[model samples]
Target: SMAQDAINRVLVDRAREGKFVVRLKGGDPFLYGRGYEEAHACAEAGIPCTVVPGVSSALSVPALAGIPVSNRGMTHEVTIVSGHLPPGHPGSLVDWEALARMRGTLVVLMGVKNSPAIADSLMAGGRSPETPAAIIVDGSLDGQVTHRCTVGTMATTLTDRGVRPPAIVVVGEVAGLPQVLTRA
Candidate 1:
């Protein structure tokens, strides 16, 4: 990530000069898209910015791939988190231990690389090793691929399948609803 703050400043500076600047992003800009942050930057500089909402992949990705993030009474609650930071990182805001204990769905975005560490954290925090997990890659794209495994085999599945970034990792029973899980 090239100094995002710097880019925000550039956008503000250009807008200050009467230049029409645009920041186009995939998914919802307000939902972890930093649209709010950029808007704040503009407001601090007295520049005007507008935010348009888009369908969040968090709800759409799994849905498009035949995985329902929620069901009738099967899923009472859902917790979405960012896995960019592995568990135990000082900057990480996620409480993997608490999440492990939650009786709900856990959806992690941008966690392909840290899937191993994440798996360990969830398991260490009391999550079942047999908890169903799914990795939806290239979501909503022509090349989309869904990888299924249990929390115990998440790291191995990822490693063995050559899973890459731009993936959404679903850790919960809902993930296994599609079919029987394939062990790594």
Candidate 2:
């Protein structure tokens, strides 16, 4: 729970010794990177810090699977959420109902464990049951698996297939584009 705090202390001590510190984080620092915590700690200790962003699994994974999240006349807006945590966790504290109700695309990173639960919640909150859904595992890596199904069947289908973590689950019309074009 104090991972960032520990990192901050190290950075602060290093800075006090007149050394410059570079903290590298996975994915966009501002987007659930928890960089803010470290930054704040460094600032309070009179240590200067800069934030650098990395490609996140949210967009990169789908792209590697040949799925464009947003296409002209297809989807204009895209929302990235996390499936790694439960609905109450800070990581998964998204308004699933509102997101499900949006007209744009939905990309869920690290959501394999909770994808089924998430799908159920969205459907219960009025998202279309027929909405296309996909689980992309090990995105942008050598071993990538894409599981295509519908929101209605996401829970059961994903469970039946034993989909795991380190995957991105996409929901909405954009997900159907690849499935239809490739017949996957």
Best-performing candidate as measured by lDDT = 1
Candidate 1's C-alpha lDDT?
Answer: 0.89
lDDT at residue 28 of model 2 (Cα atoms): 76
RMSD of 2: 3.2
TM-score of each: 0.92, 0.86
Best by TM-score: 1
| Tens-digit lDDT string for candidate 2 (1-184) | 4566687788899889888778777677777687788889988987777777788767777877777888899888999876677555565568887887787889987677777778888887789999988888777667778988889998887778887777788888888884433323
RMSD of each: 3.6, 3.2
Q: Report the lDDT of model 1 for residue 125.
A: 94
Poorest lDDT segment (10 consecutive residues) of candidate 2: 175-184
lDDT of each: 0.89, 0.79
Q: Point out the worst 10-residue segment of candidate 1 by lDDT.
A: 175-184
Q: Can you tell me which runs of candidate 1 are displaced by over 4 Å?
A: 179-184
Model 2 lDDT on a 0 to 1 scale: 0.79
In model 2, which runs have C-alpha deviations exceeding 4 angstroms? Answer: 88-92, 179-184
How much is 24 displaced in model 1, in angstroms? 0.8
